[model samples]
Target: MKTLLLLEWMKVRKYKTFWAFIILFAISLAGINYFIHNVQIQTKSLTHGMADIQIFSFPQIWSTTAWAGGFSVLLLGILIITLVTNEYSFKTHRQQIIDGISRKQFISGKWLTIIVFIIFAWISYFILTLIVGNHTENISVFSGFDYAGYFLVKMAVSLSVAFMFALLFRRSGLAIALYLVYVFILEGIVKHFLDKIAGGLGMFLPLSAGGYLVSNPMRQAIPGIETIHIQPVWILLTCLGYLILFVYLSYRYINHADL
Candidate 1:
């Protein structure tokens, strides 16, 4: 298993796309921080009036990291999809199979890469949060752990779902674009409609539930639909279901495919 992991790590290290993604993620976070900094300057306060506006702040900079990384989940998903298809793109997976690496090892290696990247992405959020400003005294024992855990779980599910889409489509860009549509567009509409019909029940869905977990608490006290008040247990179950299903399908697909 260690040998397999080492070989996979080497492949990831050598892949230009992986490095390109890291660079992109960094640039994006920096760009968002810059924009948020400007907005903070303009407002100069967390709220405007009874309007209860959701204000951006330096202390909340981690949310920018979360947004950037969360938005990039589709890209990561596409990357995962492409990793497999790229074998066909480069005629490598077939050769690896011929060289005695089982399909199981190949699939496991890809999953390990995804999990490693997921951790890196979350850590990127944490480091940026520290850079932004102060941690509020309101942070409780459970609040801090729960907030962090929620962020990590949402990221994991997003990446896993992206992998599943890639497995289904086998084309990186198309699969990723589809994933983006689901996240940014389709889910938005669904949540809006659900909010009208069921109110807080929308929190049960992945995006809505995740919105509840990571949303700035102060922002939630204000008016407008409260997508951020989701229960931790529901988000946990939804994310876990996604992770398991994606991993299972990844194995089943690769094991049975014509490859």
Candidate 2:
């Protein structure tokens, strides 16, 4: 276990590009927060009515964190995908195998690092929320707590997704590019089609359904979309299913994959 951790740490330390992503993550979050703050300032009067009333009686932190961590997940996904893909792209995996690092340990160590970073990002995001808004207005301690939980679970799910993508593509650039395309383009288009075909069932599309567990209460309250208000229980189940399915698939693939 110690050796696996050490190896993962070494991978992180030796990679400058991977480190560069931290700056990008910070910048993206800052930009989003700045935009949201400005909009809030302009519309403060309109939104003041909803401040005290808690819309989400059965609030799931996972949903809140997923909303806040949306951008973080995008950034982290790219980083993780790249990190895993680069190992294969650079032939580092073969060397690690040669050094007697079992595939299971390698996968476990990477996942451990991912979990640590996910927690760090979640805390950082919650802190940023507090920093960007007044403590009494536009913010609540419960909201922060809820979002933190969401971010942690979202990170776990995203890590599993990244692991699968990395193992499949085995090329950092390809994995990252594909992920970006899927997020920015494919998901939007696919979701629309699915929504039409399956009617209400389409709201349960993998990413969209997982999204329900972590979305902001306000955003989740938009009218006319009946299925959008997926119950917290359903959201939890969907997320769990995705996590288990992807982890099992990635594990099987990585275990049998030729370095």
Candidate 3:
């Protein structure tokens, strides 16, 4: 474990683009959360029962902020893909094998990066959780910090998707483009039609399943409580299955394909 982490650190330490990505991800997360906080503040003015309710309030903070913050996991996913593909672009993947690192170890290094990215992203949310909870209009001493676990799983699922793409394409530009298209367009269209044909079962699509895991509350989010809302344990299990599949496929590509 320590050696794998050391290898990952060696790759990340001097990489300016990696640092840029980390900085960008942090700023984007904070910016998005701030935007949501302000939007909630403004919405409170409207004459509706929903107004004056803050998602960051203590009890709801875990789930509400997680659902709100989950969107930025895509950025983290892209960074992971880029970091992996950059090795190939630089031919450093070949050199690493020349330097006596086994293919399995190389893949392990990449996997370590995924673990680290997820951890950093989760820590960022933890800090934001404190900040958002501190300044929100209401407080109740926090009922369910358990929902943060769901947020972490959602992020792992997102990063795993990117890892699989990077392994398959081996080119950052093409891989990232395909990932976005699949997530935003292809999946959207297919899920729409599939939902109609398969009943509500279409919600179990890879991305949709992750969304269901830390689903938004009925009050703050647009989706009806009955529709987007799913039992977290089931969604968690489903997403973990997807995550395992993604990692296994990526590992196979890395393990079997010539560098």
Best by TM-score: 3
How high is the CA lDDT of each candidate model? 0.67, 0.67, 0.80
Q: In model 3, which range of ten residues has the least summed lDDT? A: 217-226
Per residue, candidate 1 scores C-alpha lDDT tens digits across 73-141 of 555666776675676667777888899999988888777878887888777766765666445566432
Compose the digit string of candidate 2's lDDT tens values, residues 125-210: 76665554444444454654655665566667766676677778887878888777776678778888987888656556566665
Q: In terms of lDDT, which candidate is strongest?
A: 3
Q: State TM-scores per candidate.
A: 0.79, 0.83, 0.90
Q: Stretches of candidate 3 above 4 Å error? A: 48-50, 134-142, 217-229
RMSD of 1: 3.7
**Alpha-carbon deviation at 28 in model 1, angstroms:** 1.4
Runs in model 1 lying further than 4 Å from the true structure: 45-68, 72-75, 135-145, 190-202, 216-222, 226-229
**Predictions ranked by TM-score, top down?**
3, 2, 1
